[model samples]
Target: MEPDTLFVVGLALGVLSIPAVVSSVSRGERPRIATITLMIAGTMLVWAISNKPGGYSIEAIPAMVKRVLQGFT
Candidate 1:
């Protein structure tokens, strides 16, 4: 898979985990899976950023996401 894809997936996972963690806390349960998901997301983001040359810029993420999505359809 492409680094852009990894970055997009990581970003999505990170965003999704937020709600899961919040719900878990509200229910007085451990955020076990949610915490793990967040950790994996962070790792993916770091790996993707490191693998890309010169690293990614904040401005470049939207275009990167667009390109990755285009590949799926």
Candidate 2:
């Protein structure tokens, strides 16, 4: 898929998931830490998706890969 297409897909999914996030937190159905983490992650994903930096761009890939590697080590 194209960058724009992927971005739209990510943005749509992120926005659509917002309601579930609220419901999950409100009902105390999931752990607080997990819910909070999801919100934070979703927020970042939404920003990346909506902005013009573009999906999976060269600049983004390095930073993202760095973060992932850092997380595991």
Candidate 3:
């Protein structure tokens, strides 16, 4: 798999976990699952960033995601 793909997956997972964290906090419960998901997302993001030659630029993110998504079809 591509680093850009991993980056996208990590970002998506991190975004998805936000609601879970908020819900858990609102209910006075620990964000155990959300915390785990965040950890995984962080790891993937780190790995993807580190493995890339020149790293990533904010401007290239949209193109990267588009390429990754297009590869699936």
Output the number of the lDDT-best candidate.
1
lDDT of 1 at 31: 99
Estimate, for each residue in 1-73, the C-alpha lDDT of model 3 and write its tens digit: 6788899999999999999999999999999999999999999999999999999999998999888889889
What tens digits encode model 2's per-residue C-alpha lDDT throughout 17-48? 67777887789786455555556656666665
**Ranking 1 against 2 by lDDT, winner:** 1
Q: What TM-score does candidate 2 get on C-alpha atoms?
A: 0.44
TM-score of every candidate relative to the true structure: 0.94, 0.44, 0.94
Model 1: per-residue Cα lDDT over 2-44, one tens digit each: 7889999999999999999999999999999999999999999
Give the runs in model 3 whose Cα sits over 4 Å from its true position: none
How many backbone clashes can be found in candidate 3? 0
